[model samples]
Target: MSSKTVKLLLVGIGGYGHFYIDGIEALADQVELVAIVDPFPAQALDWPTLQAQDIPCFDTLDAFLATGITVDLAVLASPISFHADQSCALMEAGVHVLCEKPIAATIPEVERMREVRDSTGKFLEIGYQWSFSEAVQNLKTDILSGHYGMAQCLSTHVAWPRTSAYYARNSWAGKIHNAQGAPVYDSPVANATAHFLHNMLFVLGETQQSSALPRKIRAECYRVNPIENYDTACLEVETEKGDRILFYTTHAADANDGPSFLYRFEGAEIRYEIGGDIVAYLADGSIKNYGNPEGTHMRKLDVCVAKVLDADGATTPICSIEAASSHTYCVNALQQIPVYTVDPAYLQVKEIKPGEQLTFIPNMGVHLREAFEQQKLFSEMNFPWATPMGAAVVVCPIHS
Candidate 1:
């Protein structure tokens, strides 16, 4: 906390990094960009406006940190694998941090970063921007206020489409292994559907609970594409309170014409339909809609910054490393299940008319043979690279 204006640094200026530029412009009055770091030198060259402003841009974090620049906060949009090391370094340097979600690749990495934060006493906010959405905040207030009674069940669905070219665009997009264990950090729940899962967790107030943990998780996964990762999955999770959660995510289907994701409570529903707008329903049969606006994640980050600046030692409601770690675990659990293909015979059997003679086309055996052959082809092509060593469920001990 200083009397001077907040000076911020941007790290990893790639896809999401560019989106942060919009956020910076929105909050330009309160913050100034002192520096930017990206390995791709062309990224900075591509942005003439940012370049013309005389903002210092470097190709590496080591180079930027060596400049001895005085920055109050570091906005991390780096790759998922780099989060822990970069965050720990910034915290150790006495700069506050706003990091992207799935805080780190594993639970141990998350714990280490938390330890750094505790020792340095610097603010750390994991960027799960959906928590800051207007709809999410309203739902949280009502749920905590007992407006919905008790949350009996929760359901979340994320259905979007990604082509083979999408995975081919980046080397790490479909990987489960880098220098460390299985990158376990690819499509579906971990990337595309992450916000939906996080929103469900937020509305249910299932954040960082050590007493009532998820006791059981059963999952079914499918690999529709030729890649080495699952593109679709369905998960059923049971909490210690006996509450059930049904979570579904897929990147194989065609994009929906209407809303792509939805959240349902006992008496309320929130829709994030095709146009990117949000609508909520309450127990009183009232409806509220937030115009189909974009940059919702950026707004969440703004609130996160505000919370860190205003804290006198109270916990903030935004996502934390611990909560993000739990989410990573949830994704990992679902990925361990085997993929099953439906028999195709059920798809083509025609019904006979009352007066018509039945042509007994014995195609069931043929269809089963084709199904098994297709299954083998898929398994041989993908499973070798997709299967990771640590996909086993690791249940944390529940503390009273």
Candidate 2:
């Protein structure tokens, strides 16, 4: 119950950073917002909030660092590619960092940031927000307590539609690497669907034997839109501990149905479906239902605040840098493989207006589920552009 306040710096006040603002606002007593930084502050819808509060704003990390102003921790809600450099620079300046997810665009970047964190002894936390959810924590506790026994497999399918307007929000919106000469890598798996994949590794890594790292992977990455990155992908990975994860995800589907996951354990089966229901079927012929509480995306920020205020080394951030290495590896591996543009024969371009149109991936839903349930890659399911198992591209650093 320490009331100590951690002076905080807010970086990248646009897009998802709004959640961090909400989280800090909700926990105002535990932390103080010392400053804000974003290259394009005027682009943020919530820019007015910072302006109203009369908080000092800077256009770049260099400018902020030049001021010699510092804080207890910096929340990096910036681009995935910029995470490594920004986090390292801040930590070197005697600040802990909680970076947004996929940790960094590449393994080398993640490794460099880790070196800075180790050398400087500053904390580095990834913003995989679901890891901080009460429901997920209970699930992890159950898994550790042997209530679910050994995990057999984890699979998730998430499809949410996005119009061109969604991509038009920023210059780095849908590019593989930032075309604006910055390291802003934005892909569906690494950026938008990052939570689903990171959550898988986080929960599975909670067990003792599993390091939660991916040992091998086979993936089918396809782009339905004209973006530089893939809009749809199906992945099957084997973890270092011999566990498997089959993930089917995309942003080019017909609807925004939300994400769903199935975790099959030796002793039981838990299905986390859309609308926040956690249903477990046990070996005793009994069923248990847990309502997943909707957590503010900023909740992880709250957890970070509590940790910094208490100065507790024993208690770590919900998603620490080490824990997120596996997730970062997955992103890097996927990036190494070339993205195959979906055959125009399979796309139905619906004209939204004179100049804008939404690219729809035909029949993605059924095939995505089959890939997850059968623990197979999209190519194995006989998609026209899919490559078979032996022929599937393998770009993973660990497996290679």
Candidate 3:
């Protein structure tokens, strides 16, 4: 750590990069934007912002590193497939990193990154912002303190629809692999709703364990859109302690009304509505609502900046790479199982406009909510369209 301000590099100036830019600007007094590395900066929707800010840009990470510039930190908002190589390379060059989540596409990649971070003795944090929420952290504390008693189950349901334009937004939007043959696994669970998945893991285990490692995963993935990965997914995970975790999410629905989660314990229930509200149901039938205010994403960046500037390391990041490995492992395991498409007879598609359509399963939100409330798998509810995940089970090893 230095007495002077830290120099930060913004990598992949795309959709998510905008958040990092805003975050960096918010903490301008402690950090300076030295440069940006975007493989295709010209195509970035936020490229004009970078240009207007007078920040120099390079077309590749190698090109930026070649300049012999020294940045104290790198904020990676690149595609998932590129995370491991880029993070390790930057860290090897003596740069600390804050990478976007689902930390990597595979377990081995995350392991490799951990190895590099160990050898280089640099800090690497993953951008799972939900873990940094005060209320969420409080819930974790309560669970660990036995205020919630023994945990019984966890369930998550996110049903926000995506149009053709959404999937067409990028080359890796719905891909399993990028043009370079690197695994992307850019499905809903791996990318968009990854925070919720990671949050479930975080709440289940202490920050040291980070996530409750899944011993087996049974998933029924469906592709309504013509993409390499599933647009909709229903997953069941059995942890080492035999507690089950259920997840249901889709980008082929009606509206952005979800990613709601329910964490049921023997003594209480913690409920979270993505972009909405959070509430805890006590065993005594009392309702405790933990309002969901905004700004956690930006707050996380500020925390990272503070940690970088702190010589004694007093401020620590809520979500680090080691804590996010369980998420990466589950994602890797799910991607290995081939995705199944919903039968056309069960799907209802309506064209909203030219090159855009809303595809959904009728009463999807209702069904998903039911499953969550009951702590049941969608298939177990006996929906005619529900596909059994038993055959698709992929058993993954613990990160230890």
What's every prediction's RMSD, in angstroms? Answer: 10.0, 2.4, 2.3
Stretches > 4 Å off in candidate 1: 1-3, 44-46, 179-184, 206-213, 257-295, 307-317, 339-400
By summed lDDT, the worst window of 10 consecutive residues in model 2 runs over 386-395
Q: List the candidates ranked by TM-score, beginning with the highest.
A: 3, 2, 1
- Point out the higher-scoring one by TM-score: 1 or 2: 2
Cα lDDT tens digits for candidate 1, 109-164: 77899899889888788777656566566656666666556665566554565655
Please tell me which model should have the higher lDDT, number 1 or number 3.
3
TM-score, cand. 1 vs. native: 0.77
Best by TM-score: 3
TM per candidate comes to 0.77, 0.92, 0.93
RMSD of 3: 2.3
lDDT of each: 0.62, 0.79, 0.81
Among the numbered candidates, top lDDT falls to: 3
Model 2 misses residue 257 by how many Å? 2.3
Ten contiguous residues minimizing lDDT sum, candidate 3:
311-320
